[model samples]
Target: MMFEYMDKMVMFQDTPEGLTADMGWLKEAGENGWELVSSVPLIAPNRDGIAYGTVGCQMILKRPKPTQ
Candidate 1:
């Protein structure tokens, strides 16, 4: 089987709007035949070289490749 992943999901500090926005993307992905596999929050060091915790998120989804 073959599949594809979409990592463009976004979240703004895990706010309510951010949650809803990501949910919207997830919903759209399902409509396009993708099944959610995982969702992970992303964090990175700031300019001061310190992690401020979850700053964003990444979503993993996959579905069978279309017949060719």
Candidate 2:
């Protein structure tokens, strides 16, 4: 049988501040059956510090059983 699942895409800034917010949201979603699938920093570093970019977080979750 093909089970149903849920997917969510979260985006955040490359800065610490942005990460903080993103983490909080991710945590809440995880509690609801959201499993982290993949993540990547959107910043492309050059000779300087972090380049202008954002971070992307992806998560997958299995559907909860229906309450009958």
Candidate 3:
């Protein structure tokens, strides 16, 4: 069988300003037959030899490839 694939993701910041989530986008992707493969957080390291967490988020999505 043949298939097609697609990807979508959402992210935010860890600032004192604020953060936003594009749920509608994810919803639309799902409506388009996309599946959530993974949800990972973006991180960074400082000179303290320790890793710090930020408001960054990485979402991986994929859908079955379509046949011609």
Candidate 4:
């Protein structure tokens, strides 16, 4: 079940302060059992000065326990 859901899942990348998402999508994802795993921030220096990037959260969800 988890694998099936994950296969149909989609990933999104958003630039820092570039675009925003509506609350409805977040709520729907949560309701469908999507869990947040991690989030990261990216930074880079451009000709202007500095630029910021956002690596949105990641989620690893499984039905059966993951084996090590």
Runs in model 1 deviating more than 4 A are 13-22
The C-alpha TM-scores of every prediction are: 0.69, 0.39, 0.63, 0.35
Give the alpha-carbon lDDT of every model: 0.74, 0.58, 0.69, 0.45
Residue pairs clashing in model 3 are 3-65, 3-66, 4-65, 4-66
- Per residue, candidate 3 scores C-alpha lDDT tens digits across 23-57 of 77878888988888778876767899688655566
Model 4 C-alpha lDDT per residue in residues 1-68, reported as the tens digit of each score:
22323422223446597744344554566677665444343344578876755433334432333455
Worst 10 residues of 2 by lDDT: 13-22
Instruction: Provide the lDDT at 28 for model 3.
Output: 83
Report how far off residue 66 is in candidate 4 (Å). 13
Q: Give per-residue CA lDDT, model 1, range 5-56, as digits (tens).
A: 6666576644665533445766787899989788898787889989977767
Using lDDT, rank the candidates from best to worst: 1, 3, 2, 4
- 13-56, model 2: which lDDT tens digit per residue? 44755463346766777676656655545444567785755556
Q: Ten residues in a row with the worst lDDT in model 4?
A: 1-10
lDDT of 3: 0.69
- Model 1 global lDDT (CA atoms, 0 to 1): 0.74
Best by lDDT: 1
Instruction: List ranges where model 2 is wrong by over 4 Å.
Output: 1-3, 16-21, 37-54
| Pairs clashing within candidate 4 | none
Error of 4 at 52 (Å): 5.2
Candidate 1, residue 19: Cα displacement in angstroms equals 7.4
**Model 2: C-alpha RMSD to truth?**
5.5
